[model samples]
Target: MSVEIVTARWIVTGAQDETTPVIHDDAALASRDGIVLAVGPAAEIKAAYPEATVTDYPHHLIMPGLVNSHHHIGLTPLQLGAPDYALELWFAARLSMRKLDPYLDTLYSAFEMISSGITTVQHIQGWATGDLDEVLGAARGVLGAYEAVGMRASYCYAVREQNRFVYEADEDFCARLPAEAGRVMAAHLARQKMSFADFMTLYDELKAGNRNPRARIQLAPANLHWMTDDGLLAIKEKSDAEGVPMHMHLLETAYQKEYARRRTGTTAVKHLEKLGLLGPQLTLGHGVWMTEEDIEICAGTGTCICHNCSSNFRLRSGVLPLMELQRRGMVVGMGIDEAGINDDRDMLQEMRMALTVHRGPGMDHSAVPTPTQVLRMASEHGALTTAFGAEIGRLDPGRRFDAVVLDYSSATWPYQDPDIAPLDALIHRAKTKDVHAVLVDGEVIYRDGQFTRINRESILAQIAEALAKPRDTSEQETHWLRAQVFGEVERFYDGYVPADTPRIPFQQGSSRV
Candidate 1:
């Protein structure tokens, strides 16, 4: 059966021509088999598909659904305002406080994301017990929640192996280690001891369960700074072998770049390039600390970068050189980082932040990204990060009908000129509250400020209960250890160049208290 949606005052299809008007005053979009079949004047569409069921969105502006490239769905409730600290200390506190619960994590984050007009998210799944049963179980729970809430996601089991602190060491460590060794020893840990063989098995299992065509699955290497050289190379090889994209955090902070350089005798981008890991299949998050050479390398190798605006400002990580990256022909996507910083996965808010912040001192405001370009970053550029650019970013004929409708009556009224461009108003002036309807793969998943698929209240209640539980912080044993983390971070930034370097100044209108 064909479904026809009409009554959109304006439809921004995200096509090539910025002003190529496709649907005018009364437009309609028809879809069947989850693909857009037609989009044009309502009268013409209705005449073409007489028997198609019609749904009307009277005073709404319709556009492509948002694509969030990098996000941590499990970190939603941790949105506590943690400012005035560098990246390591802030990360330590977050890792210590935020306990992972599959059900609550997905429920709260998915609901917030969909409500905020983000139809697709690339979720970096958090730490899990190194047991296949536990890991796959957690993955299933998250996938189920996303499916239930009608949100498309590229869910990755974040893989890592690291040394634990002395306090976390077992008593048997005394016999296993030499006298010079501390109470703890570096242990070979895998979230799930998934060899390449085991990972393939688990991938197939998860893929089988993903019935929704819109929900994509991929493997993400957590970060180069976190993983060892062997682990990084293995991840790159595995992703290439399996034909999946590899996502990782890169050059997020100046300290991270310095740390990578000190440890590996090369910058993070150069190190990855040396390892043969910088390629089209890679998507690096938070390219704020990238050098010009690094940007050129990424462009040459076809590697993508996710520019996370909110997290950068909140954590005091420097602003990404977005215009330069675009100029070099790199695919730049937008992300909200983890939940607590941005607070919500609102793509419109992210778009606004990206545009405003990138226009720093001595830069032309007009040279910054327009609302349309920002919209493209959240939609098309984001899709490109996950290698789905050609399939899911726009609402054109033969494409998937993933779209969001904004109520223009209240939010966009009093336009002196009818030709004032609804797209501008939607990007700059609109809020999540204005989102009236959302569709994924031709299915109406959200409407009338409520979800069509999941129980929002139930999910919220579960999250509340999870947050109330007692957290375990026994791992952070000594004040010296805590201080060491912060001190290392501080020292790392000692030689930082705030003036000579390309930097985005803090916004004058920031909500700093």
Candidate 2:
């Protein structure tokens, strides 16, 4: 086992308690065979590992790499020309875009992730079609790209056996549309349909086929409204029996909360509890509309919540009650989801946003998410949602050496002051360009300005070339038809659930200014 020692001015070892990320100065971390062996003062680590090769970063901040807790295909919906619609309408707009090659698509996002110091990502792969062979191939390509980029990815093909678009049956949804638009949607649904049994079979095959340590697979039921009772139970049974972790989207929007009320007569959290799906093994994404009662269930069940602040704001999903949820001892993770305030997958900026957006109007500072808390959500807490668990989120001994090195001079050294904490500076001012190096499994996968494992420039060029093609005529036709039926979808929701109901997360389905 080769031993390597990395010495930096500051080392931020994200919380062991899983809530607060703490910083150490003049630190050195030593690793052997890709696992961290020790972390302490530079002199001590050097003295202890005299035979190890040493790499010094005199003015850098070494920290655990950011973990993106929830992602889908790595492309923002906006790239498809879909403006920030509610989650429901966003789904409709997505049909208008053209699909890219899986390998290139996956690589496109991996580059963005690496550039911004994200070492791990949970890719919730949602499908518009369920052809087993095609899905399996795409899954392999996605995993292959991550392997090539040397990023750890927890993957799950998102499963939703019902309610493809709105919270209604296909026949009912189509009936609400004009005849021509109805035919278009029905045809689309027919192409996308798959038996519940087939989904499980595909998952099993995917699990068996792709065995890369960095590419772990898990179960994800798309959402409460999109799943049937039997589908939920089957997923729960498989997850429990196999001891694999599971994640699902829950109450991402007010409409989803209302849909839960209309379907189950209770909160989505409570509904999951009754179905034996609420447990530490399951992580719920979004969860913006969760009520106090739902928070209790999440806390009691030890379930984790992934807070996608950027996606929520863009999609008009309400702000997550971060303070209340954390106070209840619920595990919270930070995710960029699809896009951030800058409409890009930049973790540093996302961290800043997560810290800022929760500062409610109050004299009590405790209501705000501190830099330490936000850092933990981006690091340690985020790892809980992935298959790596506690192995890769910290720089402590016995953990994988997954870390990012920041150019402290760029963010803090211009006016260096001992009074300001390095952690505070990083969470507040660090930018993606300030990321100097990224390491995975004790190896410097990205350094100085290039990736060691793959030809990033060539891959990106190929992606650009592919995207330059004009949209297919058939796809354009589909886009037009889908747009025509979008109003019908809104009408269906308005007719079934009055717009004035208290269950909506905001007033009139719009964000509170």
Candidate 3:
């Protein structure tokens, strides 16, 4: 039977035309076979579909489900303590920690994301183990968690050869590595520097197993920094051959810029462009240290950038010239890099941080990103970044019926002027607690503070136990090594400064990314 949901005073579809026109008194939506059939006046739609199952959501605002352009569900349990050092040091500290149980971690993160109204996530896998069976086992566990929670995701087994150098340490450190870690890392290395054959095999396996054709899942080469010239090229070739998109961390920090210049005799973006790897299929993450030439290449190639505002600020990564990128016709999407950095996968908080931060002082305060723009970055543009733009993002007839319903009566007071615009309220004032319902492909996965399809309590308990099981960190030379790896990263910032730059870090006092 068809499902009919009605009684939304306003609907924000995330369409190109900003404003989502209000329906008379009550609006309604109808869906069948997990695809939207119609959205209009309740009376009209109700009369048209007499036999449809009806759900009333009086006075609520309905909108498209959020699309998180970049997320790492497998990293949620690692949201341990704050990293008060530089990028390299923080990465080292993260590497030292014991890996969490993949099933528990994935389920915990998915539940949190769903509760906050994220219907889709482009998940970049970051864990490492030695054997192929173990690595695939961990990945399969994550995929199972996503399926169990009824969430849509684009899963990418992140690959890199450059950063592996950092992980390759003395025998003592290697000996301390978790049992599962060795197995997973080995499996990944065997397939390292992904070839066309590897890509086809993985693609075939995924395509054949996914019974729900509407579920958007793709294999991606998740490269970070200047991994390898050959590996980068191979990633591009494989993605083109399989007709899937690829993603990577590009120019995330000034350190990467320096590293790229030293290694390839060019800027990071320039290096990728030189390799002929810049295109619409490529989704570059961070892009905080981009140059004007880099911006031009992105616009010309129609490549999208995942703007990770929270992680950038947390690690002292430079601010991304967002307005400049937008002005040049570059597509931008929002991301919470790892759960450990953001502390939570709340998109509303992520959106708020993006709008307020990144605007340097003395720049017109009014020039900051507006609420609507932030919402777009997390929803429509985010979907576009992952090459799933046509499948998800907006709420419209013929599109997948993915949506989130917020309770306006919450303590956060989502109700404002009727003329204030629903999208504005959603972005500027909404909180995670305000999210009362979430749907992916017309399936009600979360509602009334509980998950409809999964056992939230059991997953939470499993993750807590997994995190509590202490691994041997005795190999760690110092406690500060767990906290701040380089002693003092701020010292490096003393003498050197950017041209005409403000003294303050980008995220100084801003709550919004």
Candidate 4:
């Protein structure tokens, strides 16, 4: 590609710390060969890169593309008939969802993310079932979709050895179910059952086959409640040997915290620490129930956490105490764990929600989350959680020129002030519709309501055609019954906690007390 200079009315140099995002006015960004060359005064850039093509936006705000730190299959659980239930029960309801073509399903979400200023995503590929060949093919289809769209992605094959559905052993949980239900559950487990060695071999083969620079594979042991000790050890060994980062769901529910004590005689963080699994290479999906000590361990080990505010609220998983997490100086990132509030995967709305939801009780104005903090989490901090590692989040001189251009006129229309901070207004008020263009590696992949590389409308049409077929009626019946089984399992888990004791996330030590 030829050299080009993108000049905007204002440019947001994303937050490098807790402070406000730095903004440059009347500036231009120069790029060539898919990398940024400079970001400085437009006049200077014009004088230096006079031969470079210039794209001018007089009423636009340019910033680094959002990095979605954690995501599962693109389809929101609610969209597929799974209502708002606890995480475990919701998983059961999700089993009934008809599977779509992996490529289309992946693109379905990719379009939403790209349209909303997200350039990179950490896709936690958890639906690895069927035969080995089928699983490999599915993985390829998903990754291929990202490659097709020119978006960066970190793909992690979720591995779990035991406790596929509920916290108990598979056989024990099945014993409590009806005969027909037991058979269905057993068959499901049988399909999911694969030896750790075989899984590692498969991962090796898949990673070797998939050499896309934009997409990388990593490891994820589902969670402490699901994986056995051996499985955890395997993940650690592989992560260490291969030098690939690992991301996993951890203590997102109160029940999980209780289960940790019963199973390991300590907190989940402590157990992971004992196993030598806490480090910079590990990123926890949701640390909603993390205690003070857990936070300390995370800070000490340089571990990262991705806060999925929308999912936690939808599932009644309790607030993540994000203010506390950031105050502790731990690496934090933002994620629309299950799309967003509207199930449209709007990063702008996600940013607003993340900023508003974590306000603690006191009247201290500074205690509330700042727009800059949320922006950093969505951009720079988020890059840390993915395989990209600081390469795609910021719009630095040497970084990849991945950015989102928002029409400032539409974002702050009807009321625009010169003194008002543009970054603050953009984060608080911008919508996906305000996004004028999205660039990846110096190329405009999405511009003016269209994807430059693919026929998005045709892809949606194909998806509609695939879903027109009626699903299996028997599978629907099992979905309804499994809800009851999962409910019973949840009740059984309550036995681990004592009625006299109040299960709190952490103890607050007051100055007077």
C-alpha positional error of residue 452 in candidate 2 after TM-score superposition, expressed in Å: 1.6
Q: After best superposition, candidate 2 residue 403: deviation in angstroms?
A: 0.3
Candidate 4 lDDT score at position 212: 81
Clashing residue pair totals per candidate (backbone < 3 A): 2, 0, 19, 0
Could you report the Cα RMSD, in angstroms, for every candidate shown? 5.2, 2.5, 5.5, 2.5
- Residue by residue across 260-335, what tens digits does model 4's lDDT show? 9889999999999999999989999989988888988999999999999888888878778787778877779888
lDDT at 366, model 2: 68
Comparing 1 with 4 on lDDT, the higher-scoring candidate is 4
Q: lDDT by residue for model 3 over 1-513, one digit each (tens)?
A: 556655576666665632333223467888887788888788888888888888877757778888778887554424554344556556545534555667777887787788888998888775445444455666677777788889888877776544442322223232344554444333333433444454445556655676644355565555545256777787777777778888788788776666676677777788788898888788889888777778888989898899988778777787888877776667788888775245778887888888777555556644566676677788878888774666777777788888898776672453477686566766778888888889888888999889998789987887777767755443232233433323322333333334554333333445455
Poorest lDDT segment (10 consecutive residues) of candidate 4: 504-513
Clashing residue pairs found in predicted model 2 = none
Q: How close is candidate 1 to the true structure, as a TM-score?
A: 0.85
Please rank every candidate by lDDT, starting with the best: 4, 2, 1, 3
Give per-residue CA lDDT, model 1, range 311-338, as digits (tens). 8887788788887886676778888877
Roughly what TM-score does model 2 have, to 2 decimal places? 0.95
* True-structure lDDT of candidate 2: 0.84
Against the true structure, whose lDDT is highest?
4
Against the reference, the lDDT scores of all candidates come to 0.71, 0.84, 0.69, 0.85
